[model samples]
Target: MANVLEPYLYLQEQHGFGQNKKSSAPGEEGSDGKRDGEESSDEDNQAPKEENDDNEDEDGKSGSSSSDDDSEDPELAKLLRENSESPSSSDNDEQPRSQPADTERKGKGRFIHQEYDSPAGNISILMIACWTMRFPVMYMDFVRLIEAYELPYLDSLRLLPPSLTLHLTKQNIQALSPHFAPTPMHMHRLTSRLAKLMFRSYNILTPECNAAPLLWRAVRGLQGNPTLYTLTKQLAHTLSLTLTIHYSLAPKLKKLKTRDPEHHKYDNAPPEVSLAATVIVVLKLVYGLDGRKRTPKDIHDPACALPNLSEYLIAIKELEERERKSKTSILSASSTSSALDMDNDMLDDYLDFCEKALLPRENRNIEHGVIRDYFPLTRHSSTPDEGVRSEVFEDSLPDAMSAVRIHENSSDLGPGNAYAIYHTQDVLGSLPEDYEKIVNRAATWAGVEEDYVCGVVERFERRLAGWWDKVRREKAETLGRVDDEVCRICIGQLIQHD
Candidate 1:
């Protein structure tokens, strides 16, 4: 199987995953078509060393003599004179720092920031398998199902690469006029086995699987697409409802006070449905899809931006209703076949959980809501009215005008206002005023200890910080040689602050 997959994997490798193209090699001709060798001059070569020497001298002078010290003191006078006479002494004490090897070699190699591309490439493989095996059905029929069900096709496809699109189309076309078509029974059996295999291989049912990247791509692709944005919000809401069920039922699974003889009847573990639903919700929320709005189009219009989305939503609502009805019937029915009973019981439990969870807390007479209430909506509202704003371009106000505007806006600001918006202090300060309260509330809603919630939040913050640091480092390393302003913005100020 590995050997069979090697060719497909190699093909994916050639495209360098889903990343933007690797930047041009260092020491090569730049965007202006000037070679690095040609761009260098005697003045340019001498300037950095000269600047470093001046900086070192200034540092030595400042460190050796402070204005607060008595200039007439014998020890202070001696130290100042020695520092003035031997600037090299101070330079030597400040160890000769070497530039990072990674900084120098960053864009020189073929694999610049390769990790960013890995997720898309990896998920594409799973998507390809689904496409080739027709586990759910042919791509066309799947699209038709989307149309019938009213799912967002373009938004989903935007998350996938063009390669997958081509493959799906080709495979579907071939299947339509194939040499022969399989009988319905054979097709069903094949699809069932393939679907099972794919799920197992991808570990879709397991909590250990890292589906974050795939979810990220899906959410990222929602930019500029209002139809997809609306669909994602609906999906997110559905996921939230599913999570509510899991939290509500978790405590009821075990009752310490119950001594009834019929207690054993309720001892069975909760269905995996809640866990599955939670995973879906977490992935979507983590990847920045959480909001609400009305559907953008009428359901029946053939030319609607998102054709069948209304029908798909309606179908989902109907299914939920049917599931609710079935749960009531199944709970009351007294069938004793264990296999049949277990399957029906699991489905019924899951449906009941979702139905109960979706209702408002006040309406349902619940004292607590879900964990979602603690967090802000991950999705941002679109800025449709405003055109693009430029910082230092022709479209921007002149520097003098900009400075005046800033002065006017920040007239009452303190020294802290000087910090950049992305600075650590500013970022951390932006958190909710009652951070512990929110954490505790969420923990109570999720039926977990506050400490566990705090731990998760800390870990997530650490990971986010690390991610941002890596991005900043990469951006700094790739700073252009020709642009001093760019260098100052990307590297100089960042390094000085650090």
Candidate 2:
């Protein structure tokens, strides 16, 4: 129990819910923040942490957080009450006794948040995947395969000792590539869309994120997924924001004071009761999507885990006690709006939070993205995901950019590195007998000389082992999207709306 609950234990039990709490240790920054709100509520249903060994084993198999259990310790009880109450009694007290029959007439039906939008790169890849991939392909199966295969394969190089990983030759690595990475046919249909989406969500969020958290940090500084946290503050897309509620916002909820009065005829139900009734409402009503359950393995996967996991969990609740306590959930009860917009105050906070981006000549991406500017003509792209790096060095255009180059010649329209990349992708699957066909087909498309294409193809073929080794080393510099692991769960919600 101590080991499991140690991190969440208040840094100084000496201080309770008041202002004097010294922000806990620097390492415990997110303890007060909401990481996964539903997950915290889920804890209430589990058997106690101090149960017998068999109970612990059952809980382990089911995958629940250990610390969410009730504690008899006076300090712990005070802290959980301070941090984990579903909806404060005061929020319940504020509810009206009954809803007017006319309240349903005020419903805002099926909004797309003319204000916030998805990163174009993210939209582009799913479009490509939708358009190109064979129909009847099992999405859930692909998700399962990725979880079972690709992730482990990627980590094998780093986790395995040299003795084993050394023999983890290129042939073995390339063998998995064809089965996992998007196929050549699939990738080409989009013309570097995934590459672009990569830059937008991943690159834009890291290093110098001038658009989002810049506004979020300056303004609300609320607890939510770092992506959605910054996003809810900066932009307010329905799908991303909804997912953020479960993964980040819901867990931080100590108590709520408000609930959506739209779908079920306004009510004064407790926040916990409301959430139990509407995990579906969180991500469901927006897209008719019934998202798959998020599991512990997925949450803990490095790709999905918060960048600063320990500190974010420790520090979040402290940062947003009042925000979380507002209990003014954007929870959608209506089939009409995504529920986020129902509460105009929260929505206003979202739209207005990103106002500083409007200064003239400030290289604005998301700031200008705000619908408030009313300058549709000035905004270049919906989201700031610079696709495809030109060569990974200079001439850095962050349009999801990296290693993607196109020939300027009008006549040739050379494929440049794209051909090489496609060739590499093909080489992963093609046998020697089929190499020429793959090479010639690629040459024809790019309008490049056959021999040049063949040579590029051959170079990759000879050093497939070395190539994968280089990939392993380079990815250390920056892997693809952290959301890549859990995307399948939400892809349906996002793509249909996009």
- Candidate 2 lDDT, 65-172, residue by residue in tens: 445343336785689577765665657655543343335433322123211122222323443354243222212223333323322322234434556656666855
Clash totals for all models, in order? 3, 45
Distance from true location, Cα of 285 in model 2, Å: 15
TM-score of 2: 0.14
Cα distance off (Å), candidate 1, residue 459: 1.5
lDDT of 1 by residue, 64-166 (tens): 2344244346886779688677767777766545335655676555354342232223333443355444332222223232322223222244334557667
Candidate 2 residue 380 Cα shift, in angstroms, is 49
The TM-score leader among the candidates is 1
- Would you list the C-alpha lDDT of every candidate in the order shown? 0.33, 0.31
The estimated TM-scores of all candidates read: 0.18, 0.14
